[model samples]
Target: MVELTKQANPGGLGPTRVLLHRPPALTSPFMLPTTGESEQAATGERGRARAALLPQRVFKKPWPCEAAFIVNILVFVYGASIGWMSPMTLLLQSDKSPVGRPLSDAEISWIASIAYLTCVPADFLIAYLSDKIGRKNSLFLLSLTSVCCWAIKLCSYEVWAFVLARALMGIVMGGAYVTCPLYTKDISEDSVRGLLGSLVILFHTTGNLFSYIIGDLLSFRIVLWICLTIAIFHLILCIIIPESPSFLIKQGKEDKAVKILAWLRCRRETDSLVQREIEIIKKEQKTDENSSNFALKAILKDKILFRAFKIAIIVALAREVCGAIPVLNFAGDIFATASKGTNFVLTPNQQAMMLGLIQVTGSMLGSSVVEKAGRKALLAVTALISGISMCALASWFVAKSYGVDAASWLPLATLCICIFCDSSGLQPVSVIITSEIFSYKYRGTVMGTAMAAAAVCAFIQMFFFKNLATSIGLHVSFYFFGAVCMFAALYTILVIPETKLRSLEEVHQDLRTKKEKREEKALKEVSV
Candidate 1:
């Protein structure tokens, strides 16, 4: 027997009318099966048999990728801003200076290094914003900094204006690093998470290439206008994308979360897979909610979480201090020195453009193979290669300092290898692994802390790198970076677990100490 009932709709449109099946009790007169009911049961069996003969249908949703792509547009803009400095610096200090006076050496150094300093605070601020306002809203708000950055440049050619613009750009840089990874991880499925996470670096490198090409070829004002237009375009796109379903669940809006998750997965709200995923999210959130300690305190108290946090911090620092930033920032000077007494002749702008192309190429390759290669293996291999390449470059410089002659191409070749390895594996995989190892409650806090530390390392490198290279030898700096990369490789091989296609609980289980595992086993046996 079918009974009509009213139920709350999970989609939140309105009350839904439902038909519930009510089987009669054996004691009731209606318990006896009627001839009509027997006929209906036979018909249902026949229908089921016919349905089983047909092929099962599958759906492949493009919504996750589409959302990730749109959100990463801000990341692309952030990359362009970083790349803009390399070319724009040359113009600012030239005879055709827009400010009517070439910037002093001190002023130029301030402009270059100030952004890294600003990134420190912005990192933490974004962590708070991402949680309070939602990932989509935080990203939308932070994107305005990029828009303001370009608008300031267009408004004035004054030195102060340029510095302020770069400072704002730094805020966007910090926020993007924190928010984009969280947003992408929340939206992506386990199978495609690595690929989508890798897109962060891919988009960043592509933006670098965009800026290098345009800043090299276009007029100063024209490049500024183009960048501004892209920033505005991102703002418009940001307004329309869905908020993360995970964030929605946290806000007690499960009905809306279900709708958004179904839309993101391109499945029906009542689909088994969708329902299972929702249950998983709720279980995770419930675990977090039941904890009495604050997020950071909880991480500190938990052995597994603390270990994971350490891994995240170590890899993040390794990526920043691996010498890529300094090499890219001072590419022209390195190229000039490397090309001396050699037939290799290229303008500074052309050299920067070439490095940009190498970066994009490496990032693309990394994104394509990340899922297949897995995060741990890829990070270790790249870090090792980058270390070896850096050591080679150092040896070449030392050879030059002595009377011994080396191949003219050695320095450039090694530098390219370092940059390529960094983009393809070290950088992107570090980010992917960090996002994969933590639960939703602690993700923002851990990411914020790690990135803020990275920003500090980057600031130190930017401020003192040139002076260190000059005071000591460039070879000494290279050797230090090489040592760090080698250390990162060794650490990854020994301690880090493969996180590709793994859930947060699975990854955390691997992170547990042997003692912890034994204790857990004992507890399970006792319960049994």
Candidate 2:
């Protein structure tokens, strides 16, 4: 008979190894194995033969990227929801409106901005749900909410119906931001975390592009059905994916955590790398368990955490006020304004589609280069570019107003640059920084609060941006947005730390003042 024994390493600091031993009787050449031993050996041989018959790659453990791709499907759906309004607004306000009347500016603003307003409350709710019910469950709930949102739109064309539908989408939007980044952070290895984290914006931009293209080509009912189908698909995928290992560990499911982490890393559960990661997660969870009950209060009390929180909020708000959302939502109107007297070749919907393509291309480039470029540098550079592009757009608008015959293509070109910069760096890097700076205990709460603030800013912009442009001139609005983007660039250079392939402690250490570091060193020496 063969015996399998697991031997623990010294101090339990290393991986447990399994040794196979034969009984003394079986060790003898003349000895015969028992029936049970024979069956076990046969089964093992068959298993080995089957494994060998298949390709080597077939047996390889799954990568975290696969999980990230699945999770970010919801993000893609959220992007589509965002893009839907761009073309749909034009359709709704046209003479052939399906609602039987042209939507008033106030009504269109409500439809466009209501989602952002509702997101504020939904952020906290999702934060709580993410901690309580687990990340995967929260995602499932959000996917269902998306389905409901699209379903409402499919069922009715009334102004109230559209507004109500957008409100439900708010819940999904708020929850997706709160949950997906945390989920991505938890599953990803430090080496590829930035790449995977950027996938959120990548998928999001692709969704936006998808929606823009389809909304232009397809009928209203068809577009709604397609979006509804996507929501359902995301819901199904959420059910199959595992809960985040961090959440599993926090819930005291160490065994399950190890299994999932091992799978995510493409290693066996007993592999040393997997064991080390599991230990790290356990340690983090233990430390968090010892901390204060209220995450918000804890953040407020700790200078380092509070600083990180502030950085997160600042970057998040910067991403929003940099004017991506309003531009995306009111793209048709912007294009119409810009092409007022120009020989522009593309229609407004086509122009918006072009912007969507720029976003996807930029997001892909960003995801590919994020780890190499590092978060801080990419964000600063992109913000600077976006600011420049916005300023150029404003300049063109100003020139046109003064009857200066600048090249008509200038606005389209500058808008493309702005959208590209946004997807490539401003949006994704902000999200990556927010997810990387905090531990699991504080991640959900901090992210929720920051996104809530961002939602408020977005709501304000969406509600009043058109009016603001009308009243103060589009040039003024562009200047304001450009200024904010420039500020974001400055802040990134001055304040934000490089988080690429870095640990939370290392990143937080960068945030500490020199005086605090000296005081900490002195305290350590005294304790010694």
Candidate 3:
């Protein structure tokens, strides 16, 4: 049942205040209105309003948020694994280690870096599986891999055993970035989408924190036991949840999709709004089918899609190469220096904990503001601030070289600010915006391609960061990061469109209009 409504009032505060608008009522004049249509439509609208009120009366809790959080806890285990090696590396080098021989530095490097190498190819493989088997099942497969990773660590102490464990972890990493975001977006209502999406990062950071604390206090075998327990736990928990409604509809299980969507939104299957949203999903699926022929080449030829793809890749690369990981890797050394000659200084492990706490806090803050402040604004503000902070840190390092005495706390403060902005702003925003911009037809492919690029960039930065710092200076490396952030900020203001609470078609339409306007302006300037 297609219902036409009036368009929103132009030239006013219309777009920000409401989701419903009264656009022209018919697709065309040939479809004339029938008798009794007006009364039926009015009755349906009231029913939708009543349905919206049921959640307030009965299910006063956010079930979707709870569900998303439950699924994302697996990410915390991944984080713990990432943080696991830091302390474990030191312990393994001691004579009291489980293997009975200290690991060489070259072996340790392979253990740390192998997951990333495997992740590049796994991105495409996992993405294909995600689209083929379904999101829920893909996640179940990821948990199985997670279990294998931890189990290998539990059962063996050989150098090859550890390397194999880390390689399996690479599959988990790829699935987490690809499948988790897509699943979270599909299951969530738009109102809480950003909040729910940010949970992935929040849980990951929390897991890292847990690893640091638990690895410090417990024996090596005990830490392995706990990590193994988490994987098995999520595998069991994910078994009970319903498959995504989008995937259900794609599979032509319309009734199941309706039931799942209704349950997730706390609405009745018969409700007009529920039915309308279902229609939208079905319509999108049909569109995807029609456009499936020659999709890869078409994506390259379509100007708007290509532009959106460019933005997504550039932002993703920036998120990785902007020095966040390198700084986190060396946080202990930076903090060690910052605390020299200071009363309020922290030890290396203590500094790790502090940064972990800050990361979780930033994610929490980002979830809160993403809906209110909008995506473009939050990204621009954070990028500009990050750029300025990097420049300040670079200058402070330069000043200390010429017989100058900067405050001991300056580096610590600056580094914290950079971390805060990254966690709270750029990292999650890049992922959210990427998922929101494209339709489902191209969503999985685009995410996989972008993540692959990001993985390569991350690999280069992780491998060569120290080498570059040695050949040039550390301060110059930071200056390069600062320049990148400034460029990113400029790109956001000039090119990015606000996508707050807008539908997929609406977002595409806005971008198309902007592109046309730019071309028109160019032509006029040439004529003048």
Candidate 4:
């Protein structure tokens, strides 16, 4: 309720309030891309190019639920396949390696870190290649690489081998991270784009949960086997996955675009949308946004785009610095101590497993609320709550140092709340906003930079969590993290605008053009 007041008031301090109850907003990215059919609409080339390209359309008018469902599952599996890499990173960091030999957590984290080291660059590469080759083919190829990486990871126990494996794994992971969003953005109808794009996170979360659960029971070799199996399945499914109609249209394959639209889309203007999407592709044929220099210069020159980039990096770094990841890695330990000391019913591992499940549930729920509450609302609430929980956890520790005889159950409860807050807000919303901030032109750049920041931050946090936790003491650490997160929450509330329902183009244009108009108007008034 106080947070609600803060929202209405916009800038002033308000009492803490309920955060989940929020209002609806418009969703955007209101058109499709260059479906081959659109090229037909471009020059009425069904007859001319028809002879050269082929009589086959991308979609054949059936619009099979079977096909859509298969696509959705494949998308989810692609996400899960790569996400398995995550828990392994922490394994490298945890005082214990996943495979049982002791190694410096930071050194192992290096392999994991270096893997993501190329993530953004890989994203830029994939985005460009997706346009050049086909989105489907590019992703399928990347998935195959992911399999090799896992096999390497499982095949060897040496640290260097692991490093190389993780690096390749990171490439595939980065590919999944980049291409999945591109696919959803390219394929889904404008009306349901938010839901569809949000599905990326959904499957990602499920993948995360799946990995965590399996990581709990299975050996590292088994996990790699599972990952490999998933990749093979993904590659098999790739043949059915349609090439982006936009790519086809850009190549002057309109007849193909039309048939795909008829089969995949439910709306009536499949033709109109198909053509409109193509024109934008043809209109900018010479000017590819995925150019190497474009991304490089985006961070350097484009002021509006750069501003969005800075926010994304800062926001992302701040998210990691808040220390949620370190806590998740230690949740079992935390829960074990707290619950055990307090005679709680659930075992620490069980509680941890449940916590993972809760995260999956929270993320799913958060996705639904995103369209309703606006990205700002969900982020603001999650940040504040997560901070409060962290602060409470810290306070409990501090109190213990002061010989207050704190209840172990109390701290454990706080840890659970922290995890819930993280799953619902920081992880999901951070990715959503990062992707949403940039338009098609710079999406790859912004996401790449932010992910890079996040990866680095995560590395630093891992290296420091144990040492920092020891030096500061659990209570103090909790308080410190809480303070950091509270500031982040406040930042979101004050600085970030709602992006939940707005079109990517609308948001991008508003960020760019609106600021220019404001500056222009200010100058005129001063002159007057």
Candidate 5:
């Protein structure tokens, strides 16, 4: 019988486990010692060697994960900013409010919708900034803009000032969405990438819930100050962390990249693990230079990249158009419609708060399990379930229109199910997959393009959903969403590749191999 033991043992942790297919009688240097005495001797040698290699530290500094955590915390502020607008809008437009005069419906609509318009262009700018200026600088821009946005809100007395504030906040939203996922993917180890990637959504939902609570309890100006304070805190914390090593490498600063990678990985620059990772980044850069141009047209023309882009666009559209945004926007209306002539316990605001909590819970669960569960399975399952839930919701609305009494509970049940599925997989999985599918050369560009498309899709859905519900039928609009979700699930199973823990080169190579096999198969069929 043979035993398996770790090989290389880089960074003071066991590396790859190798099977020693050798007889016990033949002592091999490759095989780990099986005897208790030899094992103890080997451990001592390794500990001594590690001690010699590692520099002595007076105190343990935080790991790279802490930097990721600090940067992602801004998402909470962004979420709170979004959630604050919902309740504060009511107060701002009230007849007895402090704005001096109640705002017109037109102004309110513009205030709510202006962010989408600003975000479309800002999305592309954010992508460029993240790739060109580096992730740390890009994040500083996001924080600075967020603080400015809140400051505008704190002092604004005119309708245009509120519009300007919303527009600035739109920059914060778009920048965070474009930059955070890419930065997290760059800074994280494969072991924790999924969990770290999920932080974007987790913090976002938590912020949304926090805003709901605080918006209820605090004055509007005070809430703006709270958001401003958080943004400033993020700026200070982020200033201390090193720039992403990948970004540093991209900028041709190899020495800086090495130092940053060492610090991030908590290993010496001379360590084999650090050198290996640095070599990988260098190799990836060379490969990107040799294999593909960074032009938009060139990237879209590449068959594998084009296919990946298509998958990304489809998933983005599905995430937005699957009625999640509209449902969130019209939560009160849906609750009211469902609770008509019934004894449903929660008010619209109460139901919104509950939904926010559900979103945060689902995101937290997703963060914990995404790595364990894998991406493709979770996405497929969640998309299918979300489709079914939406269909069930549509059926309930149809029944309500037809005067059915028993379908009242269906609305609440289906809505919760939809939101849960969205937060758990359909939403977070897309962000991870998008960041994974592209090479470093065009990661920011592709992510930005996808985000811009998603923003537009969301804007369209939010704008037309109520109108469609009023004119055609609520069930019809919902049925369309259900169909999109079903299509998204089917696409994932048939076309989307599993990317968990895989390197970009490995992922692209896998895609190329699959494409070649399909081409050969088609040629054989044609010959026959």
Candidate 6:
């Protein structure tokens, strides 16, 4: 869900309006918070100190540490797709996927569902273990899991083996997806949080696109082998990357974190600058540390934080049901059926694959403009436009069946619109918003939960979509999705605040205040 601002735009293309950039360090109205890491945690402390350290704010460049953007792209391109489509299609074929035993789409759907269900609990477990030991180490372990899964799938090609491999892939992919952003946030400067956040999904989209092509469009074996090899190579990059600065500080290794920070910048920064920044971060860390409650309990108690969590989760879930997966994953079959028994010569899977790749291209562009296009504004506009497009496509199909002339470009246009909505707005927004909205202590947990919604919803929708489309009719199937988009739009407009250009603490404070107000109102109304 998170997009790397740099990779987000590929070469930086998006709305110039809501540009997400950290304000320059203050000049005259200087201020600093009094806190330490023991108080606010490393993230909270750094927020305050960085400002003080920059009397004449020099916009710190992006992460200097050895980044895994290209590798992340490879991991997502290969790892996630193995789960995305081929396996599901194989089940539908009443046979195993390109390699495995055959099962009905429904049965295979259930298998995929189970895989995602596992990711929910695994998210937090992975995070705890990653932090407890180290970020790079955790990723390395996961990389091995991916390698084994692909290799096993290549050899066994059986029903149970396929299922087991997918499940294994889910767990390892879980480690990469959850830990990457936290790791990126830890190592990078605040100025590019939005960009970094966006990267998480940019790579994910690329992965999905790869799946759409290699597994669904081209052939399962080709994609599987490609991913398997790439996963192996990515391990090399993992070695060069340093550990998270936050993790090091917690370990009482400030000197190491400092050195790594410079390394991440890939430039020789002065020690005075590093020392001053560390001191400031130390002070502010105190504020967050005193009463930080990152547990589910604190999340539930904090209504606004909880509100963001709820919305993020619901939207992530709803986005799946947008019928996008069903459409993209099963479009070939659906087209054949919708053709009224016609052979339907066109390749639906190939088209979908190409579309996914195009969307990745678009996402790369959108992320660059995140800083310029204001998060809320871009999301709202894209959602509405995309919803309308889906509705139109559904109507066009129903009309064409009734002997109305629905032109060829109609369906293609609808798909393109969906990609635009998804890559540019929905995908990036889901991860970035979730990351920015939650306090640092609670961010990983909430993101894990939110992302779980996407995984779960995707499983449900992908499996049942064919049946649902047949029962409800393709026209109505898209309509229901359109309705979901509309609802998301309304909720975003009314409740979701603009997070662009705001400090993470400022956003957290707003949530905390809203919760306090709600509590105050409840207290005033109580008679007991």
lDDT of 2 by residue, 168-202 (tens): 98998999988999999999999999999999899
* Residue pairs of candidate 3 with colliding backbone atoms: 5-22, 5-23, 6-22, 6-23, 7-22, 7-23
The alpha-carbon RMSD values of the candidates against the true structure, listed in the order shown, are 10.3, 8.4, 10.1, 13.9, 9.2, 11.9
Question: Order the candidates by lDDT, highest first — what do you get?
Answer: 1, 2, 5, 3, 6, 4
Q: How does each model score on lDDT?
A: 0.86, 0.85, 0.78, 0.63, 0.81, 0.65
| Model 4's TM-score against the true structure | 0.73
Residues 395-455, candidate 6: write the lDDT tens digits. 8888888888566567766867887777787777766777666544565677677667677
The better candidate by TM-score, 1 or 3, is: 1
Compute the lDDT of residue 130 as modeled in candidate 1.
95
Model 5 residue 229 CA deviation in Å: 0.7
The regions of model 6 sitting more than 4 angstroms off are 1-74, 77-80, 83-114, 211-224, 266-285, 292-294, 337-345, 401-403, 512-528
Which model is ahead, 3 or 6, in terms of lDDT? 3
lDDT at residue 222 of model 2 (Cα atoms): 95
By lDDT, the best candidate is 1
Model 1, CA-based lDDT: 0.86
lDDT tens per residue, model 4, 324-411:
6777666655555455445666654465467667767876887677667777888889888888888777777667667678776777
Q: What's the TM-score of each model vs. the native?
A: 0.89, 0.87, 0.85, 0.73, 0.87, 0.76
Off by over 4 Å in 1: 1-60
Residue ranges of candidate 4 with Cα displaced over 4 Å: 1-128, 131-134, 153-163, 215-224, 246-263, 267-270, 273-293, 298-300, 336-341, 344-348, 509-515, 518-528
**Candidate 3 clash total?**
6
Question: Residue 326 in model 6: shift from native, Å?
Answer: 1.8
Error of 4 at 347 (Å): 5.3
